[model samples]
Structures are given as C-alpha cells and as structure tokens.
Target: MTRILPLLLLILTALAAAQTVEQEQQPIPAEPEIAEASAEEVLDIPPGDISPLAGVDLTAPGDITVMDHPDDSGDRLIVSFSPGSEAEYADLFAAYIIYRRPAGGSDEEWTNVGVMPVGEGTQFVDGYDPDFPVNIGESYEYRVSALYLDETEVMGEPVIAQEVASGQWFHQGKVRVLVACLIFLGLIFYFFSRARMGATMYLRPIAGIEAIDEAIGRATEMGKPILYVPGLSDISDVATIASLTILGRVARKVAEYQTSLIVPNRDPIVYTVAEEAVKQAYLEAGRPDSYDPNSVFFLTQSQFAFVAGVNGIMMREKPATNFYLGMFWAESLILAETGSLSGAIQIAGTDAVTQLPFFITTCDYTLIGEELYAASAYLSREPMQMGSIKGLDSCKAILMVFITAGALMSIMDLLAGTQTLSWLKNIVTTQIVD
Candidate 1:
C-alpha cells in the first residue's frame, strides 16, 4: 500500500477540492474544536444545514450552514434574534452574511450580503437594501456568522441559510481545493530537497554541456580568444544563473590553458555577476592575476544590438571557441549563424524553448529548457545545487503525469459523453475551458 501511495495521492488530488475563505479563495483556516482540538476531529454538518461559507473545512468543526438561493423568489432572508439572545452573546459585535457564486465554481470570491451594524436590533435582513437591484432567477448562497471581526481568537459558527427552491448542493464537488494545493506544494519542495541531497537521479545527458571540454581545448590550441555570451536576461533569471555557472567552469579551463577570454553581457547586473564568476574561477585555479576584468564588459540591453556586438567580436577578435549561454530570444539563430561563419567551435546553453531549435541547427550544442538550469550541478557537483536539479526533474515528472492523465481522461470522456464511465473520465475543467 505504501508503494502505491503516489498513485493514491493522485486519485485523492483528483477528487479533492478546497474550503472557501471570505472574498479570496484561500483555504479556510483550520477551525478550532468547540472544546479542544484533536488531530482527527472534523467539522460536522447537520442535515439541511449550510456552511458559513462554501467548500469543505477538514480542520473546521465541519457542521456550519452555508446559504444558497436557487431562485430569487424570496428576495429577503432574516434570522430573528431576541434581546435576551443578544445579551447572552455579549462579545458578538455584528452578524455577517456571506455568499458564493454559482455551482461548480470556486468560492474564493466574496460579496458581503448584509451586516448588522453594531448596536442594531438583534434581527438582520439580507438582500433587503434598495440600492442594489434585485437579481431574479440567479442563484445565491449565503452563510450567516456572528463575529468579533477584530479579535484574533474568535469563537463559534453562528448559523447558515440556503435557497430551498432550486438550491445548489454543496457536497457535489471536491471539498478541499486549498488543502490539495498545500499537498501539491509540499510534494514539490520535498522532491526538490531530495534531489539536492544527491539522491540517486538519472537525467538524459545534454549534448551542449558534454562538448564543453572539447570546445575549450580547441580554443586553447588555436591560441585565440574564447567568446562567452551570457544570455540577455538579468541575473535574476535562472537561465542566466546557469549560464554564469557554466562560465565559472569555462573560466577555470581558460585560466589553466592561458587562453584569452571575452564575455559580453546585455545587462549591467549580469555583467557584474559574470565578472565575479570568472574572477572566482581564476582565483580557484591558482591564477588570480590571469583573470581579465576588461574581458567581461557590458554591451547595450537591446537584443539585436547585443547580437550585433557579439557578431563583431567573433569577426574581429576571431575567438576560437564561442559559448552562448543563458536565456535568449529571436537573436539566437543570428548569434549561432555568426559564430558558425566565424569558423569558431560553438557550444551554447540556454533554457529558451522557442530559441532551442535554432541552437540545435546552428550551434555544436544546446541545453534545453531546464537542462540549461542544470549545468551548475553538472559541473559544480555541489550538494544543494544538485538537489535543485533533482527537484526540477521531479516536478517535470509530476507535470508529465498530470498532462498525460488529463489528456487521456479527456479523450475517454469525449467518447463517453458523461453518460457511461463519467467518473473515470471527468477532469476539473474550468468554465472557461468548457
């Protein structure tokens, strides 16, 4: 059974929905037990009652009434409260009315129905205001709450209301969508950490990185400068980070071979970062003085300008080896073609999906989407960094499963038309998609 946990988790996730919070569709805060909370306690719902809001509250007392109006026939709803009852719950500042959108919809959006002004009489009438136009036939669900509003440790669910005429059934859908999100995020972080710990992982070899040593050695033999173009993004981009990491390794190799290096960047911040990476690489290789600060310089931020400047570098300096690493856009093919024209051995790494095809056709090597992000771990062998790669792989696997399942189920559902085997083929599609 433990071995089947992942599959079970998927099924549960498919069936799960989230509890609705006010206004925003955040997870309903875990409701405290009426007396004292127990780990296994759940919010209990009474027959014909509604939740104070829509959705399930696994951590809630589970038994609040949520209101729904199937038809606007009864334009007004009132909860009569006696003076004695109001005196008994002295801490209750006001009564609140909560409403949800249509069925099969998320309850994250909140429109306050009505409120009992502080010190107003105990009775409150919802949908009574003349200012808002009366909505006919449109269904509305409401939950009534008596709250302190400002106090932190507010206690108790007051009462709930629903439209008995064509009422929306609350129990039809996933109860804990918010909870599902938490579980999903937890899985992501867990696998990410596992990968970083050097957990045994096998990823397909990236051709671009595999050819780095050969490219650098060829540059060394030619006794010409080596060209390094960090992608066009700022240092914040993960692709840029990967490119810089590869540059660090490349810098060390250049230092050892006493080959000249030129790195042209499109951003000042990335330029600063790349310079530091090269200096560190040189310092690490016991040739601190060999690293040239002038070699790593900032070019304009324009994509074509950067591409043109790099093309000029290849033509003028004629670097024997050219590396285009980081995030790129339309200029990818232009850069690769220029490098090819320069007769320089070109090795490129980037995570841009759109630009990948151009690199594949032109450059000797290229790193695909996340693989460009994986170069640091591939070359650095650092534990935490390697774990990040593993996390990415795990995330990819999860997405693959989700996509494949969604596609197959959709096909099955199309053939079945929700008549036979509806449950097996149903997916949580949004109203937009439907």
Candidate 2:
C-alpha cells in the first residue's frame, strides 16, 4: 500500500508540474475588455487625476467579484461592487466605473454607478429587475466596469454579473408558452445539429424568405447595393436573434448572387457580431474573398440617426432588395415607406404585431409574429426544426382548444367553471390554499 501510494504521489506531482509549466508557457491574455474603457477605447474618456484609490486596485475591472444573485425569490437583483484600484498597481489616479451590456441590449446603456475619490476605493450597486412577473425564463445580465482614467486611459477588467432564475412568471398561458418556446428553440438547435450530420431540412414556402434570392438577384441586376437591416435591438430579444439568423441566410444568397450587401446597425456590439455572421455566410458560400469588413457599418445609437443613415443608404444605393429583419420601433414606417418609394422590393419580417400592417402595405413579402420565429424552419430543411415547428403548431392548437373550451364553459356556467373556477381563481390570486 505504501509503495502504491508513493507512486500515486509521484504521478500527481508530475501532473501538477506539467500543468504549471503549461500555464506559465501560455502567454497572458492581452488586455481584458472593460465595460467602462471599452476593448477598443471607443469612449475616449481620458484618465484624469481623480485621486488614488485607497487599498483597492481599480487598474483592471477583473480584480473584483460581483454576485451572481442566483436565489430565485423573483426579486430585483442589486449588486454592489467596490473598486480595488491601487495607486502603485493602477495607471491612473482618477477613477470612474462604467458598464454596458455584453450583447448590446437597450438596458445595457452605460450608467455611472459612482466616481472614485482619491484615497478611497470606488463602489457601486446595480438594481436590475428581470421582469420577474412577466418573463420566467428570461435572463438579465450586465458587465460592471472599473475605469483608470489617467492620461494614458487604462481600463480595469469588467466584472460580469448574471442573475440566476428568480421564479419569473411565464407567458399568459404558462404551459402553452413554455411548450411553444421550447419547441421553437429546440428545433433551431436540433436542425443545426442535423445539418452538421449532412441531413437536409425540408424548408416550406415562406413568401418573404423565399424572395431573398430574387431580391439579391434584382439588386445584382440593378447594379445597386442590397440593404440588410438586422433590427436595431440587441441580441437578447428573440425577434432580433431571428433577424440575425435570417441575415446569415440572406447574406449567403447575396454573396452567391454577387450583390453588394450593406448592413447598418445602431448598436456597436451588434455591428461587430453581425459582421462576423456576414463573414461566415460569405465563407460558407465559398465567396469569402468578397466579404468586406466595412459592408457591415455602424449607424448612430440614436433611432432617427440610424433611420436617416439607412434611408440615405437606401435612397443613394437604390438597392433592389431591402431585407428588414428585426424588432423595430416608430422608425418602421419611415424605412418601409422610403424603400417603397425607391422601388426596392422590401422583404420585412418582425414579431411586432403593431407593424405587421405597414409591412403588408409596403413590403412585397412579410412574415407575421410567430413566422419570424419560424425562420429556421423556413430556411433550413432540417427535419428537427421542421418537427419543432410542427410541435409548436400542435401546442398552439392545444392552447386554442383549451382556451376556447374554458371560455365557453365560463360563459355557459358549466359545472366545472361554476363550482371550481371561483375557488381556483381565488386561491391563485390571493396565494391562499384553503
């Protein structure tokens, strides 16, 4: 036993030594991306002589730990952080903390939690409500930043905090919404998996999506650029994600048709990710050489500014095909109307029930609410995504029947509704169980 123990100890020692050597040999990661200073220093906020932080080191944002707030009592998450910026350890005397959403969400707007005073460490707390009463499955996140704004403008590593499940409420009909959302996302992953295994998905007739090839071809024929607006929102929203997914498909057809594709984005991070998606699409089409980094451009963060920029691009380039895929706001009409005037064939798809009418009037092809979510089913011919769509359809059908039956029973004062409805309603509403 002693002999075997010695041999085991030797093996453990060797593994530890090997790991240590590998870690030391591995180069330290370049600079960490700080939400305050930015990975690209796009903010250009010069470091000031704000004063040295006492005891804490704010040189890099990563030196601090933020709470995960995993408890699921369905409450708002407020995380407080202290700066660890040390004068000797940090580059700048002046310190400030800033943050942004990693995926460029509207809620990700940088908010200054607090300013660091010289000789004192900086501290800040975030109060974020994940709409606990409305969205049970939704996740809320943000990156906390520590800024060392000296003359050189060095940044601390950004600390990210994710709220754990907080017993959020589901959609109005919990079971139905749960099943449908599951089937939708499940299909996306499943179909992509099947595609990886060389299985083809049977994509159905999606009018708007089907016209992508025609639009790209028309743009090529017209010698004008193709405009791809992947929605103004960040990636958190399902609609925005659907738009981005469609963008990959649209970009592929555009690449194959050799048409100029111009993507203008309102969010900086969206611009970055969209660029990657476009580049990948082009690569998939074996036309990586045609992929232009500048094709995916950043407009302004302002809504109108983004509109004006995209409008100008559309009017000037006169793209024969404009693909509007994303969640939109009041700017929807302006873009759609302008594209209509430009004689561009607009293929618009959004989950906004309010704007569906405008798309119908101005767009040649338009996708309705769930249809936007059904895009993977439309584009990829993978059986799983198709099956998911079928599953969701089945779920929605069940929901409609249940809802109808319940309504009819309530109206007719059926026995079930008469005797049990009131009690169940009262119990659920008042959190009482008698």
Candidate 3:
C-alpha cells in the first residue's frame, strides 16, 4: 500500500510539471499603441452667432400703400405692398406680417393686425380687430414686413391711408337688386291698373283651395261639427294670419249652412283673433245668432297638452271635417292621425316644412308651401289681392328666366373654357351685403 501511494504521487507531480511547461510555451498579448498628436492639430473654436437663414438674404418690402376698403360700412382699410424681387428671395419667404397703430402712436404700440402670403403683389386687410375696431374718419399708420422661415423679420417703410373709410349712401354692389326691385314695382302697378279696369286675373288652380268648400259641405251633410285648429302660433305669425283669413271664409260657409263649428286655439291671442273672425263671418252670413261663443276658445298654452285636448275633442265630439291650418310643429301628426281615426275629412295647410309630410300622409288634402299663403287670395278674389298675386307671379317668372339663363351660361363657360360671360355671372349672383 505504501508503494502504490508513492506511485500515485509521482504521477500527480509529472502532470503538474507538464502543465507548467505548456504555460511557458504560450505567448503573452502586448498593449495597443496610439499615435502622438501635434500642438497645431488640436483646435479651440470660439462661440459665435450663426444664422439659420445664412444662405439667402431677404430684402425689405417696398411701395407700401393703404386705401379704404371698398363697399364696406366704413369699418375696414386695405393695406398693400410690393415684396421686392419675389423670385430672387422666394426661398426663405414665409409670410408678410402687417402692423398697424393709431397715427402718431409710438413704435412700441404697433399691433400685428393681419398676415398675407409671400407674393409679388401682397395685400392685407387691417380692420378685423374686434377688440379695437377701426374708427370711422380716424387716421392710422400701417407697415409691412417680410417674415423669413427662420423667424427673421425685415421691416418696411410706413404708409398712411389716403382717405378714411366711410359708408356709402347706396351700395354699388347691390345695383342689380335695386333694378330688380324697380322692375317688380312697375309690374305691380301695371297689374293693379288692369285689375281696377275689372280685368279677370287668371291664377293656377290649387287643389287644396278647391277642396275647402267640399270639406265644409261634407260636415254640413253629415250633420256633425267642423273642427278647425288655427295653429299653435300666436297672431303675429304670417301663417296664423293667413289661417285666420281662411277661417273667416270657412265660418261664413258653416254659418250659411247652420253647421256646428269648433275652433281650438293654442295661443290666447290667436283664439281672440279667431273668435272675432268667426263672429264677423257669421254676421256677414246673416246668422250671427248661430255663432257659438264657446266654439272658438283657447285650449291650452302647453304644446303637448294642447295636442291632448284636441285629441280628446276629436274623440268625444266626433267631428265630420277637420281643418288644420297654421304654423304646426311636431303635434301635426298626432292631430291628423286622431282625425283620421275618427273617420273625418281632413284638410291641412302649414308653412312648417318639417310637419308637411305628416299632414300630407294623414289628411285628405294638404296645402304645401306657398299654397297656404295664396289661399286667402284664392278665396277672396278681391281686385287688389288678385293684382298682388299676379304681380308676384310675374316676378317669379322673371326670376326663373334669369336662373335658367345663368345656369346655361355657366355650363357654356365650363365647356368652352372661356370667361366671356363672367360679367353676367357676377351680376346675377351679386347680393346685398349689410
């Protein structure tokens, strides 16, 4: 055992001696080398201002001029300038800032009023300040400067407006409107003259107007009441006024036939007006005693409550004919539907565009748009009323002619690529500016 242990120790010693010889045979790595720098090779740069727009030099704006804005109500001034050599300095041009201040005011008081794009002929309106609105007959100074892309601005010389802004007695832009009005007045005078000579003014027949008597006759034949809603609007509404006119006529017919009439009103003022109208009609028909005071009364002021009251009346009284004429809103459908359910003949007329569809759907006959306005004229047929309608018809015909001609001219200009008719287009499209 001692001999074996001596052999193992000899083997371990031999292995250690071999590993030390292998380590001595391997080569060691050397440190990296760097080249030495000369004193002249290192640079010490001083901090200096460098412009962002270093390559392009922008010139100041020139030929600054100011004038009163035309056709305005003495509230605006037009500032114009010439950005010199636009093509040469176009690279760095951003916009032109317009500066304005009261005359003789310090430079520090200058306010940037407006801006204009960089163009050869640049102009800016200087009177859009609502906080400090331009005063009439007040002197003001303005300057224009070129703003560069790098936030640099070069100022130009100042210019004063030659004339202060002032309002004109007659706007030149609305000359066409004035001419059209004059022509309409002349036409009205002509029609009135013809009507005074007992000439019959022909009008197109409206089915709604033609059906009014039929509705009244139906109620009379059935021996039932006629329900008339003068509308939810007050007496001030034109639709309500027209409804009252038609109401007077209807009441006269009902009085003549001795048929019961029921007029429900939403507005108290309209109820009063309707009551008087109905009474006058009965008097004219020689049946003033038959005009029931309780017939025409204010139902309610609340919108939906009025609808509910009218619905209750329709269900209980079971009217034979229903006439709904005036400015109606969302309640139109509910009223018409209730009358329809009661097997009543319904004639509805209104100027409210949103409620027209409901009336047209549920009512027997409906007066659409201007037909309601013309109902009184259609029924009365008085000389002055007929003449007025005729005059308005003539004006409408003239407008249609102008509109048709303008549309054709626009199409021709579009196809031909020529603006020879632009002058006519402008005249036709010119509107009155307040």
Candidate 4:
C-alpha cells in the first residue's frame, strides 16, 4: 500500500512538470503586435465578392473622369461619372463619397473631400481647401464610392488629373457694358477735339448762370458778403463736382469785385476741394491777397444741423447774395427760405427733381435738370467743355428723333391694325440679356 502511494505522488509531480514546460514554451504576445492586429481588423477592406448583409448593397459606382474646372482659378477639379442605369442601382446607394489622394500618396493618406446625396447629381466639383491651397503643378487621383444604408461602402476606380488655373483677359459677360462705355468715351473725345480747333459751340444762356455775375456784383455794391452752399453731398457726387466748378467762376467774380465770398461745406472732403478751387480762382483773378483761408470751411456732417448753421450765417451776416448749387435733399427748401427771408438774391441750382420746385419757388433764379450740369461748362466756357456739351446736345437731338419716330410708329400700328411698325418698335425698346 505504501509503494502505491509513492507511485501516485510521482505521477502527480510529472504531470505538474509537463504543465510548466508547456506554459514556458508558449510565447506571450507583445503589446504593439496585439494593437496592430486590432487595427487591421477595423481597417481591412472586405472581400470584393462578399454578399451584402440585410439592406447593404455591394455594388460599386462606374469609373469616374477628372478634369480641370473650366473658367475657374485652377484650384478646382471636376469629377464626372455616368449614373449607370438608375433603375438597376438607384435603390442600392444612400450617397456617393468623393475621395482624393495626392500624387505619390498612399491609401492611408486619401482624403474624403465631398459627399453627394443619391440621385442628386452625377458630377461633383472638388474645390480645394483654401488653407491647403492646391499646388499648381501637383497631380491628384480621385475615387467615388457608394455608401449603403447598412454602413458598407463600395469604391470605384481612381481617376488621375492635375490643376492649372489661368485668367482670361476679358470676361464674356461684360462685353455689352464695355461696348457702351467705349462709345460714350469716343463721343466725348470727338467733341473735345473739335473744341480745340476753335469751333464755336453755342449754349443757350441759362438765367441762373447769368444771374451769378449779377449776384456777386450786387453783393459787392451793397458792401455785403456772398454766400455759396456747395450742396450737402460729398465730392463723390456729380452735382457737387459741378457746384465746385461753378464756385471757381463765382470766386473769380467775387475777387474781381473785392467782395467777401463765404463758402460753407457739409463734407470735409468737399471743404478741402472748395478751398483749393476758391484759392485757384483768386490767383487767376490777380487777387490772391484778397482770398480768405477761412472762406471755405466744413460746417457739420449732420443734415439738419448744417441747415441751421447756414441759416444762422444768412441772418447774422446779411449776405447780399446766396448761391445754393449742388445736390440737395430736404434741407434745400429750408436754406432757400432762410435766404429769401434775409432779403438776399438767392440763385439755386440742383439735379434733384424733388428740390427743383422748392428752389424755383424760393429763389429768384433756378437751374433745373441738365441746366445744373451745364452751369460749369457755361460759366467756364472752356473750349473742350463747350464742345462736349455741344456733342451731348447733338446726341439728345438724335435721341428725340428716335423717340418721336417710335411713338408715331406704335400709334399708327395700334390705330390702323397694321404690323408695319413692330420691327421698329422692337429695335427701339427691346432688351436682351445673356
């Protein structure tokens, strides 16, 4: 019995030794190797012929073509593919994801740039990121993959392309505008050339322009100052520019008569321009010493506030003449009324149609519409300016003839039930846009 017990113990010890040897020979996995295997399990592509499970469809999109985007800054690529029988595969896709890989880049470096909904469009414009702007000479490869409802994706073949953005000298869209500008400029230059050749261009005398010299002379005779309001607008306005030009003439006249000329401006820029113009006029009139630096000064930018200040000047200074020439708005009436009440000879001109009535009512002489624009050329009477005005008048006469002909033709067609004037009317009135 004792012998049997020792045999059993020996057998147990052998079994323990065998188990220890087996454990020692089996290698323990390294942490990095385990992690690599786990990553592979997640990222590994499924078999090409794997059957789709449940709602997932394993069908991939057809091949795609890549090209540089036309009429764009070469930073974009146009990816196109045939939708390929929507009836057969439309239900299989939820969306198409566009993937891009840099030239010489690996599969791991591929980027998902855009996603388009199923049945939305077969083409995609891959605009590069502004932060990572496209390299002008760099090549790229793109792929389109179909995504299924069950989170499976089937990828199509890759397309290789490059970017090369170039600019156009003239855009097709602005051709009409360019042509119109050229014609207008041509007319101006032609008139200017004629004026330089000593051709007499007659302008109908404007009452307001004629009254300017009288107003300045009256102010000098009465021993009172002359007030000029160069509108409430800035120098950017066309009316203000015309007003400044006239101010040069008015300033020269005031200098000649040795009368005080007070020009109050609402814009700082206009104040600077008015000051320079008045100074130049004084110099040209041989009365530089008579020019006052404070004559042209900025009042206030506020509309109503500027009116009150100008009105205060009229009441206190008792200026003999007040000239309101330029662009005006609500303050036009207020200024003209204040000058009228002060017993000043008020001469106002403006392109503002709404303010014309107020000026005509409150002032002795008013230049309306085109007359305001014509005031500068008339007062200066520079040959170039005069020629331009004559050319403009000629154009106006031509336009009037066209208008009359068109109106007569339309009236005849309507009354006589004839289509004889249809072509003329269309030519005169129709507008085509592309």
Q: Highest lDDT among the candidates is held by which one? A: 3
Tens-place lDDT per residue, model 4, 1-434, is 86899799999999999989888565867667444333223335354534334453445666677776654555777778765333365544568888888866899978888888877788987775664445555688878887755456778877776443343455555565576567667787898999998888878888888888888888989999999999999889999999999899899989988999899999999999999999999999999999999999999999999999999999999999999999999999999999999999999999999999999999999999888889889888899889878877876776677789999988898899988857767655766343
Better of 3 and 4 by TM-score: 3
The model with the greater lDDT, 2 or 3, is: 3
| Model 4: residues with Cα > 4 Å off, grouped in runs | 1-177, 416-434
- Measured with C-alpha atoms, the lDDT of residue 123 in candidate 4 is 91
- What TM-score quantifies how close candidate 4 is to the native fold? 0.62
Candidate 3 clashing pairs, residues 3+ apart or interchain: none
Q: Global lDDT of each model?
A: 0.68, 0.69, 0.86, 0.82
Residues 1-434, model 3: lDDT tens digits: 86899799999999999989888555667767887542223222223544445665557887877788888888888777777534566765667888888888898989888777765358777678786578899988888888765567888888766667776677777777789899999999999999999998789999989998998899889999999999899988999999999999989989999999999999999988999999999999998899899999988999999999999999999999999999999999999999999999999999999999999999999999888888898999899788988998999998888788888988988999878667777666766565
Worst 10 residues of 1 by lDDT: 53-62
lDDT of 2 by residue, 1-434 (tens): 85899799999999999988888466877998766654224334445423333344334444444443333344434445554444465445445454534333465444444454555544433334232221333444444444444333445544455443354343233554456568667755764565567664454587776777777888888888888898888878878888888888888888888888899998887888889889999999999999988899888999998999899888878888888888988889899999999999898988888888988889999988888888866786556667667656656676676566656655666644454465433322343211
Sorting all predicted structures by TM-score, with the top scorer first, yields: 3, 4, 1, 2
Q: Could you tell me the TM-score of candidate 3? A: 0.67
All-Cα superposition RMSD per candidate:
23.1, 23.5, 25.1, 25.1
- Steric overlap count per candidate: 26, 21, 0, 1
